[model samples]
Target: MADKAAAQEFDILILGGGSGGYAAALRSVELGFSVGLIEKGKLGGTCLHNGCIPTKALLHSAEIAENAKTASKYGINATFDSIDMTAVNSYKDNIIAGKFRGLQGLIKSKGITVIEGEGKLTSEKTIEVNGETYTGKNIILATGSYSRSLPGLEIGGKVITSDQALKMDTVPKSAVILGGGVIGVEFASVWNSFGVDVTIVEGLPSLVPNEDAAIIKQLERAYKKRGIKFSTGIFFDNVQQNDDGVVVTLADGKKFEADLLLVAVGRGPVTANLGYEEAGLTMDRGFVITNERLHTGVGNVYAVGDIVPGLQLAHRGFQQGIFVAEEIAGLKPVVVDDANIPKVTYCEPEIASVGLTEAKAKDKLGAENVEIQEYNLAGNGKTSILGSSGLIKMVREKDGPIVGVHMIGARIGEQIGEAQLIVNWEAYPEDIASLIHAHPTQNEALGEAAMALAGKPLHG
Candidate 1:
């Protein structure tokens, strides 16, 4: 250690102790590089405090609520009870708290210097935090994101965002959710299960617009059956909130008045006044521009996670962090494309996919050079026993490897691991079909789809 008069020096200095930053810190230390991690708030960041972990916890609680109501169908005598937000919040908070504590311990064990306070990139290799200066050979910007709202529409009172939605103690009787993306639909499922009348407004043609068409249609069907109303292909014109409630109007002059309006539009990167642009890094609408290898092209600076303008997933950030650390160590890891990343939606009827959609595959390989096959979950014994119905669609090159896999159903997200491996490894249908799948398992549906694609259909 140098004299206290000089700034602390490190091999790698990271701003933002979120999933990505902390991950890079951990890995960098393991590679024998001294690391300095900086954070303004909690170490776990949005994914742990507000985004993935908390939202998924609420979704799980919603699942239990749904299961309780439908328990009679399974011959189980159970009385459905009301939701207690205080209790629910406690449970969710506990999960996050435990994880946060574990993360803190892990970082401490790794011996990385976790600088706790707001940090800004003063230069390519230096960061200033809380009246202190830390210089490093390399720098990483992992500043995450925040809940975004439409222009001219404020977020307060009756008009709230996911952050407020998670902390709500009293449940609203009716809620009009704006935007039908992942956040919108997931909240819809949760609120609906909690006995609230929920309606979603989406400008896209269907719910989960980025998903496969088949999955979208299946989700629409399930939402309709579940009494979750949605107005698709219509843009919201205006929203006005008062002490009583909110009135949401559409472009076509349709109005939905509800006790609250949830603006589930999306999240915007948090790279505003952290001195990124001042340091000469490329910026696009608050997102930092990075190369395929995640370098900023200005010195040894790099940016990862939500600020990089690709997928804003926690795992994606985690992997990128590891990749950046390994890259700095000269390990030269195999590049992971955004397309190969697995996407999972934790709604009532979950959706999961990896690689291309059918349209995308056909577009990439030409329609004639591609092949498609699907296996309905109705025929799967496990799905039938669970009283769920959906299907798995597989996209492939003609006489070649599987290029994509999309699925929708109860707990279908659990099947994404196998699908991701198949797509990422470019496995042929026969290769998966040749493997034995346990009977009466949800995983059997994937194997059945593979079998069909291999010209050896078995109970498809």
Candidate 2:
């Protein structure tokens, strides 16, 4: 950095302008710090442009198509029509464009120095972007992540990752998704609802192997009834793709072919060749290793978002960025563990969970000291009206505070705010049951679950 030309300096220089980078910038400026945020891409990174917002928009379209198909079941006489690829793409693009513009405006309003160039960590205190050096009293690395593909497998033509799948104009007649995780299942739900014959292959035994077993069972059952085929407990050995599509071979010598194969295996950290390891920062398989407070132990540098270990979620990135900003300001923000972070899967019969899973609860507490309860959504008026069936499962220490809340049902993701509060605050079941929840709403299901867990059992 000393050998470089005269460079600009700031109180904080944040690399990457994704959820984490931009978030840190906004919060840092709020704390009266001169912040510089560097990015080579759009202001809002993957989440705004590619990952969360756009994918959810696509899923919303899929939901509308499904609802139209089943309108008659609700006594509304409506005919199911075909999905116009052009209109769908137009709608998706518009949502992203609007959000992107708003985010850019927000960043500009914060009076942040937005440097548009590819940035490399030149030293513990400086970032070099396009041959221009920017030094800072404190540095934050939040380069974000990229779609990852399995080794020996290539993405092109008929085989694609989430990036290509999002921009797909025409829905394939049939699709096979590898990895039964959040990304894979969400796309499977969307493609299946669009009338595309869909199948998911996972090496794990359950679709969302991280959730409680009961929730997983309900999801598998729902998918089965929805005519979505899935093969679990088997890993794909290889994939062969041509102009005609791709065939995936399983480790058991079984093969499945589809018009297109989507590899939703997860995202990899974008810490390669950008001088992360070269700058004395510890690296674990390309992820920047940071301490509990997001400190990199390399001078005044820190790491946040997908580049840091734990949950690779956009909101988590936002929270971590804010926390880091506050920490630098001497505010000493509380650290949020990944377990307490709310996790929502936006697929049909959407899933949401916070805090511990049942298995985890039992492991942390004594098995005999963990109490559990499930309230079926059938008892909720809103759920029945929506013709959705699932249950809210709650886990707690015996005669103690609620440790977890998990749910699977239509639009259940919306209920996670209350659930996260319950779990993160360690509220007892009775504490929630004592509160008034509005009637005739899906939210009431959570209250009812709490009631049952409190041993009141007002409704089934």
Per-residue alpha-carbon lDDT of candidate 1 for residues 227-340, written as tens digits (9 for 90 to 100): 999999989999888777999999999999999999999999999999999999999999999899999999999999999988888999999999999999999998758989
Candidate 2 clashing pairs? none
Q: After superposition, how far is residue 395 of candidate 2 from its true place, in Å?
A: 0.2
**What is the clash count of model 2?**
0
TM-score of candidate 2 against the unseen true structure: 0.98
- Report the lDDT tens digits of candidate 2 across residue range 90-168: 9999999999899889988988989999999989998888887899999999999999989989888788999998888
Model 2 global lDDT (CA atoms, 0 to 1): 0.92
- Positional deviation of residue 297's Cα in model 1 after best superposition, in angstroms: 0.5
User: How displaced is residue 110 in candidate 1, in Å?
Assistant: 0.8
**RMSD to native for every prediction?**
1.1, 1.8
